[model samples]
Target: MLSNFLPFLYGISVFVLLILAAKIMLNGFVSSQASLKTQNSFSKKKKDDRTGLVTVHPELLNKDGCITDEDLLTVRFAKDSDHPQSSENPSE
Candidate 1:
């Protein structure tokens, strides 16, 4: 009888440990997701600040100088371009 009870007690302890481990993992996932959401919101807000400036391709300045709907669609921020000056550190 004692031998049978030992196996039963072991199984119950193992089950409780598994449940505790799952709870710990779930809590960690929830906190990390919340932190990730906060980080994404911060980055989105920074991007919104830069969107106030819209620059067009310099070649578009020449004849057929008029900006069309398609040209407007292609406009982007000057600081976001591939220019060397845009990549330079402000502190330098």
Candidate 2:
């Protein structure tokens, strides 16, 4: 009697696992579609040259929404040295 019931138990467990897998796949697909829907709606509401994500600061843009010619600021960091700057053992 026990041997005869084992096959049925295995079939039920396999069916349950299959159902769980299907639910996981469906959830992923639905969440992805929802994200796409939100992104599309956001772009449709904005409708601008800037695609994807746009910065909140638009002060640099001109009347045509293009950046005007301007000087770029550059930053330079001091190079690291293993020996002290005042070291007298400088190798010639």
Candidate 3:
């Protein structure tokens, strides 16, 4: 009975190792494929000279040594009409 159990345990270990090896190989293959696809797509795109160009105004930079807080813009959201205020609790 001991000899029979030893072979069964060995078989289970070998099966587990095979599964782990297959999983690692599959992950590597998938990552490599994804990297290759990204490289190919990037190469197919046309390089534009103005694509990454940016224009900045010199006045926006701080002239003094200290930092100044400039009020650039203000944004306000309009109230939604779908959810009307309940008059049951007027104090709230």
Count clashing residue pairs in model 1.
0
Tens digits of lDDT, candidate 3, 5-59: 9999999999999999999999999999999998788778855444577545565
- Local error of candidate 3 at residue 37 (angstroms): 0.4
The lDDT leader among the candidates is: 2
Candidate 3: regions farther than 4 A off: 46-92
Q: How many Å off is the CA of 15 in candidate 2?
A: 0.4
Evaluation by TM-score, superior candidate among 1 and 3? 1
lDDT, candidates in the order shown: 0.77, 0.79, 0.75
| TM-score, cand. 3 | 0.47
Highest-scoring model, TM-score: 1
Tens digit per residue, CA lDDT, model 2, 30-91: 99999999999988887775656666457677778888566545455578445335323667
Stretch of 10 with least lDDT, candidate 3: 65-74
**Model 1 lDDT on a 0 to 1 scale:** 0.77
* Tens digits of per-residue lDDT for model 1, 1-92: 99999999999999999999999999999999999999998887786545577767676565677654342333567778564343335985
**Ranking of predictions according to lDDT:** 2, 1, 3
- Clash tally, candidates in order: 0, 0, 0
Where in model 1 is the C-alpha error above 4 Å? 47-92
RMSD of 3: 19.3
